[model samples]
Target: MSSLEQANEVYNKYGAYELMKRGISEGLRHLSAPYENLQTEDQWVGAKYYGNFAGFHNNFGGNLAETKCRTASGNPPQIETTQESEELEAAMELRHNGYTKIGNIYDEDVIDEVVSRYNNIIENKEHTKSSHSNDPGDGNVYIRGIDSPQEEYFPEAEQLVTEKVKNILRNYYRSHIQIRNLRAYRTHHIPPELMESKEVYNNHWHCDGKTSDHIKLFVCLGETTEEDGPLHIMPKKYTREYAKRNASFDRETDGAPNNVVEEHGEPVKFTGVAGDVMLANTQTCLHRAGVPDEGRSRDLVQLYIAPSSEPLPENWIDSELEGADPNVWSRLLKY
Candidate 1:
């Protein structure tokens, strides 16, 4: 069989986790070459989180989740000796410290179309096979789940990322701003039964990644308030401090240290109407999920973009994303 055929068998029989592992082991020489040539010569400064890109190694609970699947007691937590000598590179467009917020970014006319498209795929459960469940301590935390294909994103919603987003990208990325992932999600649903459920350990303080690399644009699709689980993110000062210290807390299971919050002050929680936008670097600044009120829910669309425009592997095509638009996701995923 051809090498590509081998990759397909691994992907089809195993999963993305195994495919990624195979890539790192067998294709690291080819993979590292492209990533090494990234050049950034522009006004916007570039920052590296985790010192170097750790890729799958950077993942939280990647092993613990599987360990729990095999045995009851999860693996013991390890002390992370990274994150010393923090640097805060300023982006001209980032607001409220590390993100930019735009209120009422869309009108009903545009929102109705976007929401309708998102719901059709999610409600019908047409996951791209890349979706997985999150353990919300008590049960499946159903609010955030798998991703719908980008083909589901309508043209009207595409217009939302034009001028304002272009400027933000220019200020944030030194090289060309290439979008990495785009998906719409239904956040926590507050069913009557879940109302009495215990708070998830994940609903506390955490950062998305170790470094200041990826940028995420989060859009709210419905009415949101503090009662409905508002997003809380640390402002600049605390973020800067955390940058220089060793990673003290478990990002996947632990909340932000009480001392950090105490010294940096409380996180800024957002409350807004539909069509609100919050841009954040989840890699550097600590953030936590909002808890929607009982019986209430939230719709969110997120765009993850990065600077590198590396080439994907040849056999990368055998993986899922069968229904994804080649024009969109093809440009996004660079193995």
Candidate 2:
């Protein structure tokens, strides 16, 4: 079998419901061939980088002076307007900057219920496991395929996307509105002890898929305040200019050159209250989860989308999870 075929085997066995369950395991297996010839490898980033656990961002230079990501420190951005205007303005912002925010999209009652269920998974040590350790003041619990406490939680919340927001996004993302991928995470600010140990890896600026057609929607289930790990993003135009210069380059393993950073100004942080829906052109802008001051908590539902017909480099998880038993997967969920 070819590498892709062999890789698909793993995905077939323990893949889907667990999401990245086999990451650390498979990553270790690949380490046997140290200094992998990834460039010559025919696989895509989802398989080569994430599947094998290639440390792309590990090469990040922590020199802030060389960074083009401007630090935006202040109160969070504010948006106060009627429903129709908010939708239009957000759509326009998404067009211009590759991101936009719509507030109070879901009823507060629903938001609270979702947060309450996730709180048990993320906060309780016995039931919780870190998706990836974060020493940089930010951490997340991957609750998509693995620890879905309530299967109905996500399918029901799917209603939150309503007709209005779908109309706003369908054109920008360039695909029929379908939930191509779904990742719901509950994040937290790591304690000082471990925080000191985490290198400036994720805190550094980066984009999801370089020069790919993708859109990510973030549903803030809890308050994302200035000090609670708010997301900061560079404007779309700057991100496009930066992407153009380094098209086809891997962001996880590289940084913006000095000349490029000099031009791309600081990114703006979007700190939204519960029930705020934020849409982002994942490939068009550089964004990261800012470190929360003290130890505040933040929870979010991340819904991913790509043009339905766009040829996505086979996502390791999506491919593997293809035939997950819905009834069995649902049974594994907890409340």
Candidate 3:
């Protein structure tokens, strides 16, 4: 029998509890390793396995009725108009599907201004500080140390924290949320030879190790099409199945296999015009960035957020909330 068939047989025979225990065992083993000694991929494995185990327990292991009660606010936000109703429905879809896109949230002027700023930065690369990049000179340039500038260039980013957004987040998290990090980057088309040598600019499907409560708001700074390296994401249900099939979490790479993904459901690709915003629970979904077509690039502004005791503020993009830390599990987990 095939490996997938074997996984299915094991799951059917012993049930989900058995799979959970196996996953937890592997997770504990990784967690027990010394942090300093682990390589980048190993560290990712440690955090992803253990963090996902924690997320599963938090969301599913407890009392079913109690979980429902806690998640369901007895008094939901009142919806009077069509827009309000649609926003609420989108919020529900986000919770259920692990992602949802808000179309054309920003006007053309806003997109133009943001894109112009990005172009200036790109042209004047010598003066700019980059956070990281896929290659030294060519692929996926991520602008660094521009937190304040991002706020000025793309004030529409603040729209991510508006009343409607806050309501959606609050309803989903069942708690107030705060901006964890903000980033702006441009994805340039890498050479085909380089693409063959390396992973397709995060094209390998993997889950971000952040906790389940975390959601990333991806703002397209310009018109984004399938050729522009759009994001591809699997729903939460398929992610769980993928996890079960690889309960040991001992894959060769951090990404899921294409065959396994194909065996499950189709991935949803995020492709839309400028100003579209995609809200994704990256921790719960399996996702990867598509490779942009040659001679084309994609510009984006990303916001990372998580549940917090403090309520979201209007000018959250400029707030003093903690920045994006590479060691995500360190902040969220005791170990």
- Predicted structure with the largest TM-score when compared to the true one: 3
| TM-score of every candidate | 0.59, 0.56, 0.68
Model 2, poorest ten-residue lDDT window? Answer: 326-335
Candidate 2: give the clashing pairs.
16-321, 56-252, 57-252, 70-266, 97-236, 149-334
lDDT of 2 by residue, 1-335 (tens): 99677668767765664435444444444553443455323123322332211123211211121121112112112223355575556767887777887667776677777666655555564334355443233444322122433233344445456656665654443334344455555555554555344433255456553213346778776778888777777776775555555445443344422224335477677688777888886544667666666556556766665333322232223332122111211111200
* lDDT tens digits by residue: candidate 3, 178-229: 6777667667666667654556346567766444556788878778888988
The Cα local distance difference test for each model comes to 0.50, 0.49, 0.60
* Model 1 spans with C-alpha error above 4 angstroms: 1-3, 6-26, 29-96, 123-133, 136-141, 144-157, 189-201, 242-246, 252-264, 308-335
Model 1 worst lDDT window (10 residues):
39-48
For model 1, how does the per-residue alpha-carbon lDDT over 1-335 read when each residue is reduced to its tens digit? Answer: 99899899988888888687656655544554453333221001121233111122322222232222223212222222223311112244363366767556565777777667667766776652322344445545446534444634333346446445544554444334445466666666544454344334246565553224457777776677877777777765465555435333433333533334446457777667767877777655667767676676666777665544332223332324332111211222332
Task: Report residue 287 deviation for candidate 2 (angstroms).
Answer: 0.8
Cα deviation of 250, candidate 2, in Å: 8.9
lDDT of 3: 0.60
Best by lDDT: 3
Worst 10 residues of 3 by lDDT: 57-66
Q: What is the lDDT of residue 229 in candidate 2?
A: 73
